[model samples]
Target: MTTSHKQAPAFRPDWAFLMRHPAHLLAFGFGSGLARKAPGTWGTLVAYPLFFLLLALGAGPLLISLLCVPLFVLGVWACQKTGDALGVHDYGGIVWDEVVAMLLVLAWAPAGWAGWLLAFALFRLFDIVKPWPIGWFDRRVHGGFGVMLDDIIAAGFALAVQALLASWLPV
Candidate 1:
């Protein structure tokens, strides 16, 4: 006997789709999420400067880490609104999850451009590969929580990788 699974409809949100609401605008990462290819990568790239801005303001790791709670909350709401508008949960073009995930990874990442770069690569790797728990959440969860949970798991993985490398790798 063969089991068949139905796939969710694919959607490629355009610029106008993001313009419909403020949440959509943010969830789309100010249009970076609208990229025809690798929208998540683009969204992650957009996160770097924002992270730097907070660091530049003298926000310590603790502050940055604490910010994750509110950011995740906002991200959930934004993702929910945008997902509802798009009629898809965790749409590829909805990239606020990537943006927030970068923040979580960087919150624990070592200081310096090299550290940030490594964190970025690892986060993207796990986000794309979705191993173990991340894949489980991505498959089992739905709605806004589902959208953000997998990326948050990926960030946790990236954080561990970054910590492991920081002790051994020279920057």
Candidate 2:
């Protein structure tokens, strides 16, 4: 519902826009990059794994981090295409960016409740602020990697901030 940018293109939300619905959320990821045709499809498809992020991660951080690049790529593309599909830049429903960003932020974070909590807060903050390099990347770049790197950068900033906070606070 919150608009992120003023320059958002003017595409109408389509069936894939239904992916934003809460009912068929699971199915959204199945069609993230698919054409925007069905209701609640892509959003549902992408949202499940996003929901999974706070719950589980059986793999090691390095592996998961590596896995994230492609997913980040996917997120970038998803955001751009979703924007194009809906005629908006950084649409609210295109949370695939948030998904990739959150993962990237925690990719190497300490696996503690405190660390996770701090990371979540810092990540969301940095994402919203788009500070420093995050802002730089968000503004100057274009395309999939462009969409992704700003978040990736913000996540890195959050990681650094969280690490410092963790060290200083020490739960």
Candidate 3:
């Protein structure tokens, strides 16, 4: 039989397209978001190393929290611009929101890899599952605020779960 080849599906705003704008470059997590699969998860993984570096630099919870505010605020606008360029709101490849939200999670996470692992797992779970008000906002809200809120809400849930785990799990 003759060999048959499968064509790969195209991903949007490929690096060249996103590279035209700095905002898109960042909102795309410096290209981590460009992954053909599970972009958001890749973006979160990108955030992990950065957070570890910050921790190494002795960035305590307060400083990390302080840093997140601006990222969250700026991400709103950056995401909007990138979305407009991509012709889709909150495109899977647009993951600055995940980056900032991860920062928020890490800011409050405990002082070791175990805690970091827990936070990452919890954040990803809540983000993907989108329970309760998170789902509500995801459905009802639109645009940049909408894009960011669900993750923020997910972070809230993750924080709560982390708190509960801290109380009981002794990890």
**What's the TM-score of every candidate structure?**
0.91, 0.68, 0.89
- The list of candidate 1 runs beyond 4 A from truth reads 1-12
* Most lDDT-accurate candidate: 1
Candidate 2 or 3, higher TM-score? 3
Which lDDT tens digits does candidate 3 get at residues 15-85? 79777999898889989998988999998887887788888998988898888888888888888777776
Candidate 1, 101-152: lDDT as tens digits: 8988887888877888899999999999999989988988877778888999
lDDT of 2 by residue, 1-171 (tens): 222344644654445564665311211244443345432233323433553563475666677778777877666656565555555455444555655667666666666667666767787778777778788777777654565677678778887887778775446
Looking at model 2, residue 121 earns an lDDT score of 77
Candidate 3 or 1, higher TM-score: 1
Which candidate number would show the highest TM-score if scored against the true structure?
Answer: 1
Q: At residue 129, what lDDT does model 3 achieve?
A: 92
Question: What lDDT would each prediction earn against the true structure?
Answer: 0.84, 0.58, 0.82
Clashing pairs in 3: none
Q: List runs of model 3 lying over 4 Å from the truth.
A: 1-11, 168-171
Ranking by TM-score: 1, 3, 2
